[model samples]
Target: MHAPDRPASYAHPARLILILSLAPTVGLGIGRFAYALVLPDMRDTLAWSYSAAGFMNTINAAGYLAGALFASRMIRRFGLAASVRWGTLACVLSLALCAITGNFYVLSFARLLAGVGAAAGFVGGGALAATIAQSRPERANFLLSLFYAGPGIGILASGLAAPFVLQGFGPGSWWIVWWAMTALAVVMTIPVLLAPFHARAALTETTAVKFAVAPVVIYLTGYFLFGAGYIAYMTFMIAYIRDAGGGAAAQSAFWSLIGVSAFATPWVWRRVLALDRGGLATTIILGVNAIGAAMPIFGHSVWLLATSALVFGVAFFAVVGSTTAFVRFNYPPQAWPTAIAAMTISFGIGQTLGPIVVGAITDALGSLSFALNVSAAMLALGAVLSAFQRKVRSF
Candidate 1:
C-alpha cells in the first residue's frame, strides 16, 4: 500500500522520527502549555475570573478527548500524512484566531478547536512513530522516547520567546504572544509537509484481541491522577510566581529550565524505563514529580523554584513514555493501540476535570497555593495507587 508518489525525504526511520517530534511541539507546547505563559496578561486584559480562565482549558481538554477518540478512525481511513497535515493546519489556524479575538466565549471556542487539532497531530504522529519503531525493533524504545521529548523543543521556544514578545509589544498585548506562537508553529510545519504517507507494506495489527485491563487498572488510575494533578501546576505556575512577586526574568528562567531539563529525560531515565516492572517504575517517578510539584510552596527562593522546574520538567514527560512502555511490555503488538488509547482517554478525562476543579478551589480558597497543594496531594495519591500495580502475568 505504499504510495509511489510520496516524498522520498522521510523514507528513513531516523529522519521520520525527527520530523514526527514536531507534532508534540505543536500539539502540547504551543497548543496547550503556552496558555500558562500568557495567562496572567490574558486574565488582566480580558478581566476574567480564575474560574472563567480555567474554563478555557476545560473546553480545550474536552476537544482533546473527542479527538483522541476519533484519531485512530481517521488514520485508518485517511492515512497518516493527511491526518497530520489537516490536524496541524487546523491547529495553526486555531492559534491564529487566538491572536485576533478578545471575546471570552470566542477565545474558549478557539482553545477547544486547537485542542482537537493538537490531538489529531499527536495521535497521528504517535502512530507513525510506532510504525517506524516497529520496523526497527532494536531501537524502538529510543525512537519512541525521542518522539515524546519533542514537546521540550516547543516548551523551550515558548519559554524564551513569550517574555520578549510581551516585553517587545508591551504588557497589555497578550495577543502578540499568540501570534508569535503561531509563526513558530508555521515554521515547524515544513518538516511535516516533506514527510511521506507510506508505512511498511505488511503492517497489519489484529483487531479482535481480547485483553484484560485489571492488572494495569491501578497504573491507569495513577496516570489519571497524574493528569489531574500535574496540569494544575502547569496551568497556574506563572500566575503563582507573579503573585509571589517574581518578575519576568524569574518566569523565563523557571519555565525555560523546565524545558531544558525535559530534553534530557531519555538519558536520565533510560535504565528505569527499560525495566519491565510494570507500574513500580511509574510510581517512583510520580513520587519525584509530586515532590517537584510541591517545591514552590516550600520556599520562595529562586533556587527553590528552579529546582522545582528542573525536577518536574524532567519527570513529567517521561511519565507518558512510561505508559507507552508499559503497554509494549505487557501486551502483544496487536493490542498496543487499544492499550495506549485507553490510557490516553483516561489521561484526557482527568485533564478535562483538573482545571475547573482546581480553578474553583483557587476561587474558594483565595489562593493559588491551596489549589497547588491539592494538586500535589492528588499526585501523591496517584503514586500510591501505582505502587499497587504488578506486572501483567500473561505478557
Candidate 2:
C-alpha cells in the first residue's frame, strides 16, 4: 500500500528534474531577470528616474515577500505540482500585462504580480526538486544544482533575443520584447506542467514538524545579504554596460556569458556542495560571487566584465543550491517545505530593499560604480558571516 518516492519505473530522474526546472526558467530567468535587458530602453522611453526604475523590481520583490510569507501554507494545501503550475501561470499573465500597458502603475502592478508568482513557483519547484534529489543522495548536490541552474536557460534565451529586438526596433520597443518573452514563458511552462512531481517529502509532516531558526540564523542573515547584493548587479548591469558605451552586441555578450557560465555550476561545485560543513559551501560560493560583483567596479574592461560575468553567473545559483543542500543535510525530509520557505523569507526581505536602495544611491551620487561597490561590499560581508556557521547536529 505504500508508494515509492518516485515512479518505480522512472528510468531518468534527471529528465524529470529538467522539466521541473522550467518553473524557475519562467519565473526567474525570463520573468524577473529579463527586466535587466529591457531597462535601458524603458528608462529612456518613459523618462523615469533611476529610483523609479528600481521601484519596478522593488514592487516585484515586495510581492515576492508576500508570496514567500504564504508559500508554506500554499504548498501544504495544494501540493507542490499545483503550486508550481499556478505560480507559472501567474508569471505568464504578468508578462502579457507588461506587453499591453505602458502605464507606470499598471506596469508596477504587473511586476508585483510576477514577483508573487515567481516566489510561489520558486519555492514549490525547489521543494519538488529536493524530493527528486532524495532519490540519489550521492548526486544530490549536482542534481540540485541542475534545478537551480534552470534560470540560466531563461537568461540565455532572453539575452540572445531581447537585446537584438530592442536594438532593431529602437527605443519604445520594450513592449515587443516583453511579448516575445511572454510566448517563451508560455512554452517553458508547458514542460513544467507536464513534469512528474508526485512525491511528497513534507506534506504529511506539515503539522507534526516545525522548522528551527536559531541554529541557522547566521546563515539566514548571510543569505539575506546575498539577496540584497546580487539583485543590484542583476537589475542594473545592462544599464551599466550601456552607460559605458557598450553596444547591443556587448550587452548581449555579457549577459549571455553569465547565462552560459550558469550551466557549469553543477559540475564546478558538485564537490563543494556535497560538503557536510553547513555554510562552508555557501561561504566559498559567496566569496566567488562577491569577487565577481566587485569586478566591474574596479574598472569596466572588456575582459574584466566577461570574467565577472563568468564568475558571478556560475556561483550565484550554486549559492542557492548550497542552502537547499544545507536544509537536506540538517533537516528531516518532512520539514523541507517549511525550512525552504523560511530561507526564502529571509532572502525576500533583503531583495525587497536591494534594488530600490541601490537605485537611490546611484541617483543621488550620480555614479553607478559607487552603487555596485556598495553591493559588492554587502556580498563580501555576507561571505565572512557565513564562514562562521557550522553544521547543525540533529537530535
Q: What is candidate 2's lDDT per residue for 1-395, written digit by digit as tens? A: 11226545345768878888888889899989999999999999989899999999999899988888898898888888788899999999999999998899999999999999998998888887887776776676788888999999999999999999998998899999999999999999988877666545435334435777898899999999999999999999999999999999999999999899888999999999988897999999999999999999878799999999999999998988999888888877677778888899999998999999999999999989988998899999999999988887754
Error of 1 at 285 (Å): 1.9
Residue 388's lDDT in candidate 1: 85
Q: Could you tell me which residue pairs clash in candidate 1?
A: none
In every candidate, how many clashes are there? 0, 0
Instruction: Report lDDT (CA) for all predictions.
Output: 0.80, 0.88
Alpha-carbon RMSD, candidate 2:
2.1
List the candidates' TM-scores in order.
0.93, 0.97
Residue 241, candidate 1: Cα error in Å is: 1.0
Q: How high a TM-score does candidate 2 get?
A: 0.97
lDDT of 1 by residue, 56-118 (tens): 888888888888777767766666667777888778888899999898878988889888888
lDDT of 1 at 101: 89
